[model samples]
Structures are given as C-alpha cells and as structure tokens.
Target: MGFRNLQTFLFFLLLMLLGLSAPLSAAEGKRLALVVGNSAYTATTPLANAAADARAFAAFLKENGFEVDSLINVDRAGFARGLSTFSKKIGPADTALFYFAGHGMQLKGENFLLGLDAELLSEFDVDAEAIALNSITGIMERKASLSLLFVDACRNNPIADRLNASVEGVTRGAALKWGWRR
Candidate 1:
C-alpha cells in the first residue's frame, strides 16, 4: 500500500485494537498520546511533510479523545523533556500512544529516531545524540496497560551510510520489538 494509506490503516487498526482491549467503564483509564515531528534538521536534508503530518495526526487523535502532547521540529533536549513529561503523565491503566515523524536509522540492530538538532559525526554520536526506540517502548511497557507506537521516519539514512563505511562489521538489521510480553 501507499505510505499515506499505510498510515491511515495503522491509525484505524490501533484504534480498533484499543477498542477491543480496553475496559468498557469510563473510570478504568484515559487515552494519552505523544506525537512528535522533526522537519527542520540542522544536519541533514529536511523533510517537507513531517511536521504537518504530525500536526494533522495529533489533531485527529485529540478528536478521538486522546490527551495529545504534540511537538514539532524539536531538538534533542526538547525530545527528552517531552518524553519525561509523557512518562510522568501516564497512569497504570492508561492507554498510551507515541507517534514520530522524522529521520530514523538502524545501527547494528538498534533503531534510533533523530531529533532536529542531531548531528551524527560518527557512530558514537548515534548513541549520544539520537533517541533509542527502545527507550520509548520501555517507558510504555512500565507505565501503561496498552501502548502503541507509530514511527513515520525514513529507514535509509545518509548518516548510517557514512557510519557504516567508516566502521567494520556494521551490519544493518531490523531490531524493533514491542508488545505486552516484551
């Protein structure tokens, strides 16, 4: 399917899954969403649609009863702050959602989402500068009963190419894992 269609499908599927698993009573929990988009990258080619798409999706989530926290073109500090605030807001029984629209890359097996201010000078920079996808999942795993993550970022990264060229045995692979069991 097309990218836009895939996004729509994923959104509806997430809602349907939540509807199926959620408790019927209103007192059970609330829906919370953290939506972030980075378009104005200082170190790489800027994405034209990331921020707008995130804004639109955040609006949709808000309309669907989510307490949405949206961020656009956020730097590294802002990304961390947003996550910290989001984690604090999540309750034990809450349904949490995280949506990211930006540049992303996988290094050696770990997936990372880039911030607007990310500048990857070397492989070491990835761990220090980028936000690990696992960190986001970890927060959801600890804080929420039901959690969903939608990453709308590019898989092929120019920085990854440069890093791979400089480092040996840097094999690319998919490493994203999520669910109640994980």
Candidate 2:
C-alpha cells in the first residue's frame, strides 16, 4: 500500500509539472482600475490639487497598459457607482488596482476616504460620506488575484488653518495617520 501511495503522489507531481510547463499563456488581458480625486468640496472646502492629480495618474495608468476607470469629484452616489462599475468592468484582468487621492480620516480606528464636499459636522458623517477602506477590500474581494490599493489622502482636516483660527485652540496634530499594514 505504501509503495502504491508513493507512486500515486509521484504521478500527480509529474502531472503538475507538465501542466506548469504547458504554454497556458494569455495576453495580460484587461487591467481594470479605479482612480478617485476629491477636489471640489462644498462644506469642507475644495482640496488643493487632487483633480489634476487624478487626471495625470489616469493618463499614466493607461500609458502603462491598463484599462482605467477613473472618477473625479466623486460624492456619495458617485463613489458608490464608481465602485460597483469598476468591479463589474473587470473581465479576466491580469491586474486590478484601486487608487484614491483626497481627504481621508480615521474614526473608530477605521480608515475612511473623504469624498469631495464631505462636511465634518459630526463623526457619524465620516462613515456616511467617506468610503471605508475595508469597503474597497470587500467589493474587490473575489475580483482579482493580485489586488493593489493606493491611498494618498491626508488624515488632517484639510481646512485646519481656518478651523483653528475660528475655533480656539487646535494646533496641528501629527501627520502619521497614513501608515499601511502590509
């Protein structure tokens, strides 16, 4: 019985090696992407230069052989739609990436990317208006083999300059809220 099992294992290993050697190659199919820039804001004021950034990045991604789906000034509805659309557009893509450049904050120890026109009125609005970082993971869960996410949003309230003066005492806090975990 032991010898028969060993022979069976060797046969399976040989078959796997043969399969690996087979020319199962396909053109790097379609590369899907989601690029978001929150530049135009109403309550919290507009971001500095995120719109231009997103445009430039989208162009770069296309040049680098990617089918990009980018959205600028994505609000609540726009953000949701962009996510759903991007997920659906991925058709046998060799690579999938999600990128964001805008205002973002951490509440309840969770990452939230702030969209354009997001008002920091109450903390609950963080979950309401902003896109949860994990949401990206969930929507992209079974979409691709190797997934990539890039977030360039700052954690600081972008309008802290005015907010500090208007309020009373709120010095600039540390800017270490954008660290990544593996």
Candidate 3:
C-alpha cells in the first residue's frame, strides 16, 4: 500500500484496538497518548509527511477520549524531556499510547528512533542522540496496564549504508528494526 494509505490504515487500526481495549479498563482507567513526529533531520533524508501524520493522529486520539501530548520536529533534548513528562503522567490504570513518525535505525541488536536534530556521525553517537525502542517500551511497561507503541520509520534507508562500511569490527547482519508497534 501507499505511504499515506498505510498511515491511514494504521491510525484506524489503533483506533479499533483502543476501542476493543477500552472496555477492559472501563471500570477504572484513563487513556493517554504521546504523539511525536520528526520530519526535519540534520543527518539523514528528510521525510515528506511525518509531521502531518503525527498531527492527524494526535487529533484522532484526542477525539477518541485520550489525553494527548503531541510534539513535532523534536530534538534530542526535547525528545527526552517529552518522554520524561509523559512517563510522569502515566498511572497504573492508564492505557498509555506512544506514536512516532520519523527516521529510525537498529544497531548492535538495539533499535533507535532518530530525533529531528540527530547527527549520526558515527554509530556510537546513536545511544547519545537517538531514542531507544526498548527505553520507550520499558517506561510504559512499568506503569500502564495496556501500552501501545507505534513507530512509522524507514525500513531501508541510505543511512543504513554506514553499517556496510568496513569499519573494523562492526557486524554485517545488523537488522534495522524501524517500526515499534506493540
């Protein structure tokens, strides 16, 4: 399917999943969402529709009874701060949802979502600048009964070429796990 169509499908799928999940916590719970879109990248190719997708998804979530926290073109500091703020808001009874549309990568068996101002000069810089997929998942896993993480990122990007470079001991079969939908 086309990119826009895929995004639409994913949004509807989230809505349906949330709808189904709502009744499970109907007795006592709140729906919370953190929607992030990183379109302007300094180290990689810029995306055409990530910001728009985030905005639309945030709107849909807000209309569907979620207390939404939306962000666009976030830098590394902003990204970290946003997560920290969102995590503090999550409660045991909250169904937390995280949605991200941007560039992402995986190295050394760890997945990462790139920030708007991320400068991936070397693989080592990833840990310092990018958001780890597991970190996001871990935060939600701690507090929420039901947590959903949706990431719309490039699967095969030119940035992946760095892994292929004969840089001493860097592994060859590194799988770039971009999307984090759970």
| lDDT, each prediction | 0.83, 0.65, 0.78
Each prediction's number of clashing residue pairs: 0, 0, 0
In angstroms, give how far residue 73 of model 2 lies from its true place. Answer: 1.4
Off by over 4 Å in 3: 2-8, 20-27, 166-182
**What lDDT does model 1 reach?**
0.83
The candidate scoring highest on TM-score is 1
TM-score versus the correct structure, for each prediction: 0.88, 0.69, 0.82
Worst 10 residues of 2 by lDDT: 173-182
Candidate 2 runs further than 4 Å off: 1-28, 91-93, 158-182
Per-residue accuracy of model 1 over 126-173 as CA lDDT, tens digit each: 887899999999899889988888888865567666778887534344
TM-score of 1: 0.88
- Candidates 2 and 3 compared: the better one by TM-score is 3
CA displacement after TM-score superposition, residue 46 of candidate 3 (Å): 0.8
Q: Rank the candidates by lDDT, best first.
A: 1, 3, 2
lDDT of 2 at 15: 45
